[model samples]
Target: MLPKRSISKSKPSKVWSYFVKSENGGKCKLCQKFVKSSGNTTNLTNHLKRNHKKIYLNEKQLEIGKETAGPSNVNLFNLEAKASTSKAKFPKTDSESKYSDINTDERMDSGSEYSHRSPTPTAAKNSDVNVVICTSTDSQSQSFVSQKGRKRQQRIDQSFSDISSFSEGGNKANKVTNAIIFMIAKDNCPLNITEKVGFQYLMRTVAPSYHIPGRKTISNLMDEKYEVLFKLMKDKISSIKHFCFTSDVWTDTLNSRSFVGVTVHMVCENKLLNLTIALEELSKHHTGEYLADKLSNIFRHWEIPLEKFVAAVTDNGSNIVKAISILLGKSKHLPCFAHTLNLVAQKVCEDDAIHEIIKAVKQIITFFKHSVAASDELRKRNDLKLIQSVPTRWNSTYYMLEKFVKISEDVGTVLLKFPDAPRMLTAGELQIINEIISNLKPIEQVSKEISGDSYVTASIVIPLQNCMIKQISNLSPATDIGKHLKQIILSEITKRFGEIEGVSLLTIATLLDLRFKTIHFNSPLKLSHSVMKLKRLIEESQNEIINEETIEEPTKNENTGSIWDYHMQLSSHDKRTRRENGKENNAGINELDHYFSQPLVDRKVNPIQFWFEHKLAYPVLFEIAAQYFPIVATSVPTERLFSRAGNIMDPSRNRLSSTKFGRLLFLNSLELIGIYNIQIK
Candidate 1:
């Protein structure tokens, strides 16, 4: 066996150590990141002043040390200053260049706080002259090493061309949209979703240059770039106008604080020009007035001119309405006519006689709905038509009122035409039918032009004509019914203790249309139910939030709502129960549940709410927009920029400064071929 070699002692690491020659010509101490101040510290000082001038420093000592830092003293900046005389030596490399290795070594050291770090070459190798090392303990800096190995320059125009069941989209979206998303997460959506779903899908469809990563990549990216994406989006959002505002804030089933959301929508020049998201977090003691005040402050910060506001719509919450009043100096509200009509029908049905008629009609409807033969027979009776009549159910009660009248006539005319059809009889039933038929008489030709005798039809025609005229008379589509709804909104009246006009007119009109419940002193259901509904709506209005921007949507690129409704549709994960996604994930990451479960106000209270509250309202607004306003908007132009943004900065390359995101969006907008009309090439 060979004799064991003697162990040799190795030198200690000289990382922070520097052999500085003392003024007495003796070595004093060593320092790592710091060395002698040459012409280097001068540039560093200037850079600090320019870049980090406002950043926090040990200011307590900086001012005092400034005067003492003049010269001569070994203690400058209250720290030892190394002399340039004894410069440290570094290794040399063979390239036939003068101290080439030494230059590389110095360059490597340039990765200090004193330097602006540039992206290091990916192919670099560790060596005496070209060592790859990181000084900071920050884990983020280290991730770059891996990016070099995995990242590829996105096929700028084909990012989403071949989504292997996946892809992505937007304008440096990771940077621009992420910032917006981050801000949203802070207040509205807490779902911890790093990648947007609909946008991602749309990216694959619209912009061919975007692609979503694999699932594993997405999960990892979520962790790393969540913050980056949010900041980027926010930065991009900071510069826009005419934003569509959508707000849905709610408490848990527990009914806690008022969590409000403010989303801005601007579809300009045929693109979704800007979609900004904001959240208004309120304490439990929040009120309409307090909420309005806070919202006013935020609007002032955004430079949004309240005068330019085309509309401020909200769900039926009084508080949100108050906020809108604050957001848009004042408003002439438009309430949902459909909702009012529902109320009217509800009232007319409340009468005992009308109630019996409704019951009888509904039963008859159900009977025919359940029987295809009866429905077919009714259609055939209406001039011998097809196999079936659409709307076999009673829901189209108004139109059905006319159809049922025909059915009754047909039954009476062809009473023995079929055995399956039920016979019409009974004095009481017939009397009720007479009332229903009489009310519908004038509109139809059931009776002769004058019946040749006035008194013959006075009992029916007088009341029916008055009801129809009254119900249809007060209707002013130009005025959103909800404007004077306060008279009917119990909460508003109770809380304010004020009387409202148009209440009786509205109620009587509603009764004529069979759209309202009878509100009589003798009723047990109580008047408060109606008021409670109004209260609920006002309460919801009191808690709305939204953002706005100015961009017109191009009719050519307009979204007629695809197989998936992007803007108007809710995110699927909006199910309130979903908090955290996978187990063992970072804590507080899964806040999406808070967003989906948020309480919403009624559309009646807030005009915006009317469009978002019901499917009918949304389409109604679309029709109104298409007809009244130039349906082609500039909002889509802004969305295209956002789409471009998401394209540039995505999960794969998430981190980005806000400034860069804005610049990219601006560039994309200028390059637009067409926003209003789809351009050829």
Candidate 2:
């Protein structure tokens, strides 16, 4: 036989004709390379069984479905093809009739038509994948229609029309609103602002087009998106574990005191995380109870159990202690030790001799500050020591003491060098100069002690170094008269500062072991209330609050106003007497707060095991305290949080309707509520 012409060589009309008889071959509809009978058909059937069995089986299912679908005359699958098809198109002429009768076996050999790409008869049998549903074309109707088919059609069509109208119309917006939805979903690519353009731009591009507005429109959209982000951020914060709060209210340049409360929260770790959670503007009229109530509500909203709170740290204040007790449940108070020591120095130095000594030293300092020549002369002296400057305040008291130690000898030398030095040495000044001279050995000793093995509290060295005198009662002085000074240092060091102040929790701290055994100051008659009480006193001191004073410059010409500062106007009197004649019981009570706050020395074996190893966890201890005392100490990490919150949700851009602000507090405070742990941060 002549080599068979390739299907590609056949004319299109011949190929169509050849396809007719080949349909009778009963081959597998797909992979039509084989005939469906005898050897070839058996192999083809096995191939379908191995590879296309499910698809082939589905065709069989559709064939049966077609058969059962009502009647032969009403084939639903073929309805569309049949509805508009004309019966008249069948051959009607004699030539047409004769061609229809020709034998058709040879046409079976040709397979070109079976290999074409049109949807096959078998494919049409499966309707689900083949069904082509149309969408609605109307978007002018402003309503949420549920039909996906209708909406898709309307949206896709309108997008183009919308776009065309904007670009085409130029002056007006299209009927439909053009916008984008900024969203934060729970999965991949969690947050987004789909710069979706409206109908005007959609219609312009043949394919779907987006409308990007002018600069102002972009800015407005960005602003809106920012709002969504704030809500999410606010929510994320509210979900944190617990909240820790730290707050401080102080005088500003205006002399108006404002209370700023910051919240710290726990995020992924113990490492301090988010701070900008809640930065509540505490009203000046508010009391501790009001603060507690406000703070309690925020904690309640976050669902962080308030009972777990460690303690609320505050600048010493009683009302705040009371409020923290009420809100977070008692045992939630931790007085800032930093402030407590300042007041201690104040009470201790208030004695006539000590105060005058300090003033005399300061006078020498003033003399030098006033005249650099004197400072230079003193600095050049062999015995003079230079130390860091310490600002005076309760917090600065420790540092100021250290500063004085540094330049003390220099000052004394300056006084001795200048007979004309306005600051003449008085008896108290002499005592102070003596004290200043006495400090040289201790200063050198503390310098060495600072590096040697620590005994009681390392926290003290740096802080004490900052103050009136370092190693006040720690190291024994080697001077011939240093034995007395050494006794003073040891005796005071023996007294537990925390016990003296009444912070019971500090027993676990290093304050428990301080050895205060000096014979100079007499012991109290009876042990006083908890040292924590003093902490409370310092915390809650609002008695002489300079409430909202307007600070202004004093008049330059008035002696009473400018020339005479409160510090400068006070007359210096030499009253160095500390007589113990008949005032035995009230030795320093007339000038001090009250009785001794230190815990009495306990004479028991295993005091460590005896004191600690209580069956109760630390948190449990607070809970137990709550049952008895009205207040509880807390950590209140919130102070750390709100600081970070301000930056993250920048106040300028992170605006919210007040309701949202509360939510922001919840999110940030929840984790920070680790204050719930009853441990110091």
Candidate 3:
């Protein structure tokens, strides 16, 4: 009903003083309501808990008089009251008080205490027999220090002090660090971010108290983080028995430097994992030997099991081909499908009709892009903005032409407004633009479908190539440009991939796909060859498994005493020796045969998931599928890594070391070991 002020002036409680004021009959600070000064603090305590629960829960009662305060502190006023109730139980006589200052230590043993009664007590019964024990071993004379007739008047205050320091801001510091790293990676900020006045100002404005780390501190932190993430990834790689790699070399022309990137792919627990395994800056020669040595070093460093290495996909460059062949054997290197397609598209676009149309289109787009007035007028006509083609990029020309078609009328109007503007495209040129889009559309679609890193793209290569060639053959030479385009594409494809390459690893990938299963192949001879290859591979794997089992459990020869038993054993051994050869010859032939006899998989089925569900039915084949399915048809994974590196090591930041550049690129791509997983301001 009332609030009370603590009497202990030497040490006061901040919580009590703050909530219950000493003015106006103990007014509550939060509610400003007057309470009766009846020496009761129930109302004040309730008010603080109800009105300001958040502050009340987090704030600790401060010790005003102590040199150092702790989290745990008992109320001195309450302890004194408990001591007074227990004083009457322990009484002392005058005789004990006379010798209270004698040599008590000499009379008592090693285990001793100064007081005979308990210094503090919480019950009435325990306080009656409370006494102090000595801690010395010298038992010269037994002398009592206190009298039995006198009650103990003085009380000894006891308090437990907590020694651990408070540092609850560690979580906040971690969050800030993650935010800084995220900004550096996502926005491609320089490592010397703290040195820049603008960056420092921005960070200070956002968080005034946050201590920004120096460049070296940040770099060391990232290096430490890299080791942690590498261990996790290394463990995952070690667990996988089979995997494939996609590698490529990227030339940064502005910096005149080249780098090699390798991406690792595998299926673990029915889910596909595509991760950038290596992105190394190459300062040495780009010769076959140099590249091969670099790749071998990385494989050895990561402990990549070469015995399980299936194949590698790279561009058609001779050095790359030779390098991959050296590392993974000659039969295992796959020329990047997307690069071959780019070349085919590039060659087909070389016709005079297509060239004239692309030139005019580029001129028109450049005019609109440069002249803001022209762009505004074009935007008013149609809100579509034109995209200029980059010669180095694939599918860029198709996109440029397609965008122009959408805003063709606007362009015609814009050109009419300026007499000195580039000449408008003729009807024939416009026709060529539409034809180019038609011819290149299929190439663009197929490129995207195969470049996907998450699923089985190799299986679709043969089927998709067959479909493209058939589409090109049906063009019927409707125009001069159409005939030229069709001829260029067919020649390029026939020269690069052809029929035989399809029946190679590409067909093996398709055979693994239950969805396609030899149904799309037109040539019976190639189909039979693929089936035979699949059977042979499976048989080899089965033999390896059997040989290992045999090594683990070898047969033993023991002699029998009876002549009849010995004769039977000799005959059985001869029969068993012949059967072993036959079993080895056809170790895993039936699994393939059984799969071929089954119905073809449906068109809409997911190949990876299908293999996963049916893995137990054909476990050996599943192991083979894991080896082949992750082989991406293109080196796009490495190319994408180069794209990020390009942004990081820009012309202005050319002085950035390769280590910093690679780490930044890696952090940008993989989100720096899951810094992006945290939601930070």
Candidate 4:
């Protein structure tokens, strides 16, 4: 081997420098022997041979380190201060090496304490450079290294510094608690999830010192949140002059308890507010009188005027219909249009081929869901898993079938692996599923559009009704499934929605939509009747406004010449001229006439926002629009609330009290509350 240079042959390493400067410096890396920090490796080689005898690579590793320890590596230990000044050098004697190991404990105990000793004669010979170095002998070793001590002490102090910086005076802790509560309320997680060891460990990882509260504390927090939200809801509902309600009944499968969910829809500050006002558990029988009494109590509790309840939109259940008739009148009940369409979809799904396809798809989904081994195998084969559909909701079924068709090949392969696989879909059956999806896609789109809570869904009812009929008529009759499904859906639509064409409430809502106006009505007579009804509503609203103004006008002192007085005079003149023109012009001319004559609003424009923007121009008509526009075409908002309630009061949380369950649902739907408002755009 070539003569080893006093340099390491290992690759240039920043990591090796850390070890060289560590407190364990001067000790052999492999054998823990104390050696001189100087270049000579005689003692280090002997220690490695004796201690690491069985390790054959020790000799090679030592040689590599000996050759590669260059000037760049020396600065790592701050040894240049001594090495630069010393022109003369002394090699390590055997006694010095032995004494170095002997005084290890004493040196470690001394830590950063420094002492000074005069330099030797050989070092003082050339020039007085004051070279500082640590020697093995206690009598010879002068001062402890000041620079290394400071750096090491800094690192030690940093590790245990105040942990308060990890959190911003408990703001981060509060956010964590808020997120936990939201998940529990939103997903209906069990209250005891906070108690789990794994969950606690996870929290500790994020905030090691934070004390997570128990379930009871979380319950109290939620109750406080609900109270703040309820006060807000009550204020919003009481402030709005008119509102339409949707109420539906749901029975908890776990406890056999029935709940009546009531959602209030009204326009407040130009944005549509769909708030679930009450979700009361009813012990009484669901008779029309009892339900009507329950509804009356709710309105009474909220301090909403009975007359201000414009209409009640509900499912076709006779008891609900009769209850609304008892509370208001028969004319005030608007049957849910989406519920009517769901009935139509149900009628179409009665076909045998469609039924069988749904059954096979359900089986495939159940197999993977219930069997871990089969699910694992399916996961390996394809990423898309089959989704099971709810029988009560036709749109869910359509989506499930759509996904099943997309991943049929992987599903077939995965099914063959299992002994009890569902029967593979036949060619004819596959065609039927594809055809059903194509036919139901348009209907599904219409359902989702009208079920929306944010925008104006009530206005879309008439246009979608007309659009669906035209779409069904235009479908090619190439497939028998398409032809049969179309006939069934069309007949159901005409039967359920045809009579709705004359419903003055729906027609008024459609006319208020800048996108539809009177154009949605196919018949000239329907348009004429709708326009007549809207004009009457506007006139009645105008008279009410005039009466209220007249009552307030006498209380204030009159001014005829001020700027405000001049503005009032211009407004009075404008209204007087319009009234005079109304008498002089055609008998049917009103805001509706002018609105209809104006070009139809842009298709992409929001009708609710349009009416809000123009409320000042046609004040009476806008007030009337508020009454009809908030009437939903479906009781789906109330139904969706029940779905959320079901998740909250699921089997694990079945023992949860009704009051607490209702409160959680209230907070979950706070985004829909008008006081917790969002901009329309």
Best by lDDT: 4
The Cα error of candidate 1 at residue 150, in Å, is 39
Ranking by TM-score: 3, 4, 2, 1
Question: What TM-score does model 1 achieve against the real structure?
Answer: 0.28
> In model 3, where do residues sit more than 4 Å from their true spots?
1-169, 194-209, 500-503, 554-587, 602-604, 651-653, 671-681
Q: Which has the better TM-score: candidate 1, or candidate 4?
A: 4
Cα lDDT of model 1 overall?
Answer: 0.33
Cα misplacement distance, residue 530 of candidate 2 (Å): 18
Q: Per-residue alpha-carbon lDDT of model 1 for 1-681, expressed as tens digits?
A: 999999988763221111222232212111001123342334333333332222112222333544653222211111111111221121111222222212222122222333345544343454322234333211112222324344333242332322221123322222223232223322222223326765454333332233334435433333333332233233333333334343434432222334444434442222332333333446655566776676565456455555434444344567666666666544323222222323344443344655555555556556566777666777676763212223322224444544555456664544355565555544455544444434333233322221211111111222332344344334332222222221232232133212211232122212111112232212224334433443333233222211111122233235676865564334423321232332312111122222223354331232122323442423322222211111111122222333444454455334433433333333233212111100000
Question: Distance (Å) between predicted and true CA of 123, model 3?
Answer: 49
What TM-score does each of the candidates earn?
0.28, 0.35, 0.69, 0.66
Candidate 4's residue-wise lDDT over 1-681, tens digit each? Answer: 999779768664322321122343343322222444344444444544443332223224334654663211211111111112332122111122311121321121211113233322221112423323333212212233334233112232322332332233232344345456656766678888898887776555344434677888677656655654464346335546778999999998789899889988887666777777789889988999999999999889888887987788999999999999999999989998888888888877777756866887788888889999888887887888778898878888998999989988888887788888777787777777887887787788888888877777778888998887887778775678767877777888888887777988788888888898877788888888888888777777666665665566534326755668766767666655766666523333466677778898688897768877897776667777788778888888898998899778877788888888888787677633322211000
Question: What lDDT does model 3 reach?
Answer: 0.65
Ten-residue segment with the worst summed lDDT in candidate 3?
158-167
Scored against the true structure, residue 185 in model 4 reaches a CA lDDT of 69
**Better lDDT candidate (2, 4):** 4
Q: Write the per-residue lDDT of candidate 2 for residues 1-681, one digit (tens) a residue.
A: 799866765333211211112433432222212233342244444544453443334334444654563212211111111122333322111112311111111011112222333322211123223322222122122122223333322355544454354342121121111112111111111111223343223322211222334434433333433333343334334333334444554322222324345443332211224343344545556677777776676566444567544445666676667777787656656665434444444444454555555565556556667777776787677454433335454323334445665555556656777776756455444544355345433433443333211122222332233332434544444443435444443334344242422334432222222232111112232123333433343323221121211121233223666545554334211111211232322222321232124343443222223223431332222222222121112222333334433433433324433333333444333223221110000
Span of ten consecutive residues with least summed lDDT in model 4 = 74-83
